[model samples]
Target chain A: MTGFGHNSEDEAEGRIEALAEMMARLPGLGPRSARRAVLHMLQRRDLLMTPLADAMHDVAAAARECVQCGNLSTAETCAICREERRANGEICVVEDVASLWAMERAGAFRGRYHVLGGLLSALDNVGPDDLRIPRLRGRIADEGVREVILALPATVDGQTTAHYVADAVEGSATVSTLAQGVPVGGELDYLDDGTIGAALRARRSL
Target chain B: MTGFGHNSEDEAEGRIEALAEMMARLPGLGPRSARRAVLHMLQRRDLLMTPLADAMHDVAAAARECVQCGNLSTAETCAICREERRANGEICVVEDVASLWAMERAGAFRGRYHVLGGLLSALDNVGPDDLRIPRLRGRIADEGVREVILALPATVDGQTTAHYVADAVEGSATVSTLAQGVPVGGELDYLDDGTIGAALRARRSL
Candidate 1:
């Protein structure tokens, strides 16, 4: 298998190239960077590459969606969804688990979350039923949810999903959207016109 | 584990965080991008994450350094070193396997390679015996090598290593270094002083 210069060499190279190609599919990595990453991993197999492979395999085997909120979890329900105190009659709805994680990272939302998995997109033919809207309405009544805060993006599809969710849970809970305006530490010059206008319109008396 | 939010929940989160931390150790990924990549992978476990994990495991299990040249291979010797036709009395000496790969990608060199693993560095206290210089000397005599082209970088350490290698293989084979100047498509304005000087000194007549 070694010094004979047969097709086994191509097979070995193929394994490495296949790994690089798979790595390139990740969010921030491209073909060249993926190759470099693969090479770096190969150079530090004991220290980095083997450990990375184990971690990925562990996550792949364990990770699942929270049955209640659609968040990534190892169990049927996620940590936040299972916490008794988190059921504070408020459910913050987000377009995906990433946004849900962002809210958790901020540590501002003590209430539970409801991950929609995606927004309603007319362009992509995504409808209300396509998301977790039906499940959200079920949670509002079953969990005694009083407020459903939409922590969705400011995109058209996001707003459309929010509106649809609001309508779906019309009589059950109070529906609200995340504040739209200039961000914290944001410069006025760098802000777009829509943001500036929203900031001006939603001005506080302070 | 499904509904009880005890230590198991934290353990679940730990698995994900651990995966993200490992991903962050990659060349181009940071903490945030690593988290995002993890989330993306979790979402498409069967489609992307599982395949990635399998590929990484395969590479980790099979990948090994070639005994002859230090290039990556599954066998004792690399494909180039094993190919009889590639033993054309020319050995392209490189600093690492990555440089060897870059040269392979260019497909301009038709001979075997000798990977030095690293260059001579005074600051790091790396000396001749620290690299593959002695092994290279052995190859030059044993393999009937005629030319040893140093395709190392233009860094100070790279040049230092090249000079050391040239002296080491002085009487055994013809030694040469890669030409320095403005890159093929590069403008003179972007080239450094040393490169311009080298280009002027090594100017060839039509």
Candidate 2:
């Protein structure tokens, strides 16, 4: 008998294979794990599977990066930017949208964010305009932003980008960064909320 | 100022919350990890998010449990049952649909399956009827089945149910159970294909 009792050329087979391919591309998932995950999702479709799919569809159709801050949102301006109360003369700069969300999850930073999209990488030929650094400079001057908090990684590339941004906005705004003891090679995404809060509370001058 | 610059109760907030809630219900996921997962999905919407959501939607709409064997399928009868060659007079019985799929992953067991749904459990008040025992009995008589291979867990309830099934089907057909070496408290879902195959090959009389 055929394995799985289904011809690979059949319609159902094609759909399953497609799903497996997509799942395999996700971080930490390989072909074998993807197959298991697909089967699991199929069995739990009524509860976990269906809702996950619907959420994905809704987000796919509506999601866009905030033009000003690079945070994922459905609008040109992210919700924080649109809120008048959030215009508190401060901006927390991060390397990615994931980091920005991490800060939000900690519930410690009440200031707005400026997503750099990525850190400067000479090996990858990335430069200032490659990120939103120019936009950040304009925001500091125009929006009366007083304090700039850098939450970039401790990696060489991240530090380079941090120093570059600090220099660019040096005279116009005060610059600081989250303190060390946040762990080496750890992303803000994996930090405990309290740890993040501590790092934010102990931020140091650049 | 709010981080990421969005109004607290905006459409984006609603969508993100919905996604996080659904993710939290997934196996091995909690509320905090679910939030992180949703944020990751949002950041990679173009590459990983959109396709995964589409696959989830398609499977949610089309997937259904095989009425005959309890395996997930897109039709009334699963592909395994519909295959003429797979109806080889031998039925590998399993406690749940997951074990059956695990067997299929091994590309062995060239026969049909009868998913028991769950094992008999007196403590929880589950009995033979709570499983697919009646349907299995009917299949033995109707399909000219020659063997019934039990691949249930090694739990107290699982073994008790196996014996009960063996006694019930003794006169009607040959009954067998997978051999030991399966870890205690381990579900067939977690066994490697090799272990499952070895267990199947070394099966003994019930």
Candidate 3:
């Protein structure tokens, strides 16, 4: 089996391997899964792969990050940033667009957003400047943002960045974070000791 | 947040949603995963999405199923069918190209393959004509094939088809199948009684 797809990966027929390798770069896929995906795509060209190719081409040709908030769009400003109703004096700061999308999925926040691109990583050489932190501080004052919600994760870097942002806009804007506690529907028996401790310490009025 | 992407999906900006839906059609993806994949692809255009688009385009333009055995390729005959050394008087009959690929992966089968497309299914209204049954019979005589190896699954339809092919070449060539017993690395303790019985029945001396 080694030589089956091997020779094809050689000079005259390396396209399939190249395609598989590129697919391996996708978030949840690896080389073997990539090969399966490529094979499936090849077999279902008219129904699945062609449309995917076309969609990617169109998006590649047009996709642009919102100049104001870093959200993805095909326009100068993303639809979220363009909506006047969303400009209700609050901006939710998120680590990346995926988190922004996750927040959007919740449909709880009515205000706009500010994508920080990534969490600050000192060891990996990723700093405040590496992300959109400067852009965010500028937006806080320029956009007349009243409250900034830190919808970042509970990781060390996430908390550090949250504190950094809170300090940056100290008196000008109130900074809040998503509640930290046992998730709804989570069983106490399965909860970690740290989570149980935190939940007990931060017991709510309810 | 749920309503944010929803409205955008409903409006004239339907390209991304359409792309996401098409991506959902892939083997292991669903709507939510598809949306994430598309969003990630959009964000990583230069480094990831563009190259993926290019590969998909190239594959879409060039990919063709093998004329001889239905394997996927960019040529009329797939690499295996085109290899003269692989014409070793043996033919492995498989139900699909994936199985053929798997057999090739084993690196044990040095002979060429014949893809039957699918097993005969009376429920699906599939007959021998629906698969490449006639083609197999023709190739056996034409190529002076000495043996036919049935690598079909251990399903009812698989056995029926295997027996059908065995009868088809009763006079000309010997017919065999992949062993019907415990797989390598499988624990006998975990195997079902039927498998254990089969293993006992087909026991060999060392």
Q: Which run of 10 residues does model 3 chain A get worst, by summed lDDT?
A: A1-10
- List DockQ for all candidates: 0.50, 0.26, 0.34
Where does model 3 exceed 4 Å of error? A1-13, B1-13, B189-193
Q: Count clashing residue pairs in model 1.
A: 0
lDDT of 1 by residue, A1-206 (tens): 35444334446567788888889999999988898999999878899988888888888887777888988887667888878999999999998888988898899999999999898888898877788888888898899999989898998888888888888999999988889999999999999999999999999997
TM-score of chain A of 3: 0.88
lDDT of 1 at B2: 54
What's the TM-score of chain A alone for every prediction? Answer: 0.92, 0.79, 0.88
Candidate 2 or 1, higher lDDT: 1
After superposition, the stretches of candidate 1 with alpha carbons farther than 4 Å from their true spots are A1-9, B1-9, B187-197, B200-206
Task: Give the CA lDDT, 0 to 100, for residue A30 in model 1.
Answer: 90
Give a tens-digit lDDT track for model 2, residues A3-68: 234332235545666887886765455677677778778767777788788887787666677777
- Per-residue lDDT of candidate 1, residues B1-206 (tens digit): 35544344456667888889999999999999999999888878899988988888788877787778888876667677878999999999999977987898889999999999898998999999899889999999899999999999989999889999999999999998888766789888888888889899989998
Best by TM-score: 1
What TM-score would every model get versus the actual structure?
0.91, 0.78, 0.90
Give me the iRMSD of candidate 1, please.
Answer: 3.5
Q: Which digits, one per residue and each the tens of the lDDT, describe model 3 over residues A74-180?
A: 66567888788998999999988778878988899999999998888787778878888778878888889999999998888999889988888788889898887
Better of 1 and 2 by TM-score: 1
